[model samples]
Target: MALQLIPLPPALWTSLPGRSSVRTVADVIGSTQPWRPISLTPDLTLNTLLSLLPPAAILVGIASIAREDRMRLLSVILVGGGVSVVIGLVQITSRDLYFFRITNPGYPVGVFANRNHQAALVACMLPMLGVFAGLRQGARAGAKLQAAFAAVAAIALLPFVLANGSRAGLGLAIAGLAAGLILYAGHQGAWSSLTRSRAWRLSAGAAALAGVVLVGAAALYSRNDAITRISSATTAEDQRFQFIPQMTHMTADFFPVGSGFGSFDSVFRSYEPSEALLRTYFNHAHNDALELAIEAGAFGFIVLTVLLGWWATRAAHYWRDMSRDSSARRFGRLGSVVIGILFVASLVDYPLRTPLLGCIFFVAACWMHLEPTGRTQKTD
Candidate 1:
């Protein structure tokens, strides 16, 4: 049956200047007036909003100490993730529904509006979730569970990442894995007494050699016709290089107070024209270093650098103190692995922009920095 539309009240219609011409409520909402005053809400300011998030997340993570609390936190994240996946599916199924072409052709976007962002969100969440699941069980049990989840997430995510065809995401994921492994080994004290033992030295040497050989083999394998086509299709080197000059130009023009947080894309396009082969609109500078430098300038960069340095120092301190406690060691290991992945991921992608992933990483870093003395204090 066809539904009948309800008519608006005469008083409501009379209140609007052009109500007679408006066909629907959307038309009323769409109209803009020059005389309207701007609202200065706390949420409207980027810095203010960013400030509120970390503390809140830390509090929540701190509160999640009991098994039930931990489960609850995990449930929330998973539900959010599931919702994101459904949104991604809808965006793909109803291509014509969204105005932005980028949101469609649904890559594993999860709940994110952007596929790359979605991939980054998943990458950050999955590792931590896997680690938590692992740590909840015995060492062997945890390792098995983590490995299974990691494998499944990786497999499920790989095709979606491929569908998005983001070279940056692929590169970041590989880098993240490498970083995770290094941190994992460090937390395990796998290299602590290296100089004292010939076995350790030999093992480290062999691992390094194997890594080099594996990389070389992969490079050679990727040069095949099928691989070459795929590689060429996904490659972003040319586009990335093109933006370096543009970034430099934009940075110089807006040296001190950046064009503003959400103003980079507009400013960049105005600064440089798109190359014929690369006519895509770029919202970010592709490099986090460059993007931050451009958006926040030197001051913001210094603050970020100092924060990272402090976090790293804390991580090191806690790591060193993990010698006595087995639980602390496990926590340090998992936390370091997660942080390493995020640090590496940030070098190429803008996962830091997403609140969920960013909050998790920030809190995890803080958690890892806590020095565990003899007794295990209950941390919620």
Candidate 2:
């Protein structure tokens, strides 16, 4: 942010990518201006930096809580998700039913501005259902009941991902579901006895048959379903793809130093392809990594590299060490799976840019640090 405020010399400022565009626009508007080259729009840099606070605060709060409360936190999140789903369904009835004025009307946006963001949240939550159900410390009967609830809830949630109308979200939903099932299977030690039991073979075959039935049912159920929309998608591809090649050029134009945080909207004008221009303007690159390159340049890539390395290392350890006997460890592994979902979602869409998903991401990151403990304490 401080870098944005620093007024660099004309030589430095003029050499940057957006300088000519800014100069020409200023001249056209008949305004003489002193240039602050570090960021053509410093206010954007400040605002973008400020946006990180909520997620950072969430991370700190989650990390500070007693390990037991993490599960409670997860439960609260799931409850909120349920409420969001309900609200989204309601939004389908009328545009007036939307929760916010600046929202995608007639779509199931829930508390988000976009349906895809809401879908991403839903997708991320799907895996944690297993963790939530399995992590409870209680009698055998109670545990079984909890598992049943989770099973039903998972079934309920899967259709919403399809109904939400996000192909990326649908894909991630499948991945999250698969990750959860893999975790569950590992917990059951199913891999060790896969070939040893006729019962296992029967169960596997039945599961495969059920999956086929579900897919066929889903395809036939709704015109707006994920499968249907995906199959019927226009061959021309989304306009977002057009922005990528231009964005790649912008990334190179900025090179080591970027236009500045949150500057994509401003700097993008300089490189936007003529054919790609439309009545609607892009606020982001859609592909977050490429956008981040245009905004933060090499620094963004370095930060991403470090974070990815950390996540990979922790995920491998969590997977290897997770066990059915330890709820905390299992929860950690599940959290990793949830984080993976969001990370993959970022490839095609910027899920983390939204506050709700951003906070969830950080909290999930904290969950990766969970340690096994016997005592239970309320989160203050």
Q: Using TM-score, give the best candidate's number.
A: 2
Error at 155, model 1, angstroms: 6.0
Off by over 4 Å in 1: 1-101, 104-106, 136-164, 175-230, 233-237, 274-280, 318-325, 375-380
Task: For candidate 2, write residues 1-380 as lDDT tens digits.
Answer: 56766888665676776467766776788876555657768988888889999998887787788877876788888999989888887877665567566666777888888888998888777778766656544468887788789778888876677677788877777666666565555445444344435544644664564455446657666734667667887646676675677788898888777888888898887677787788877878877888788787888899889988988988876655333335566677877888888888888788889989998888788778776454432111
lDDT against the true structure, each candidate: 0.51, 0.74
Off by over 4 Å in 2: 9-11, 15-18, 23-37, 137-139, 186-214, 321-325, 371-380
TM-score of 2: 0.86
Model 1, residue pairs in steric clash: 62-380, 64-380, 65-380, 84-110, 84-111, 134-142
lDDT of 1 by residue, 56-146 (tens): 7666766656533433444465557656655665655665334355563534465555656665655455444444444433357666776
- Top lDDT model: 2
Model 2 scores what on Cα lDDT?
0.74
> Looking at model 1, which ten-residue stretch has the lowest summed lDDT?
34-43
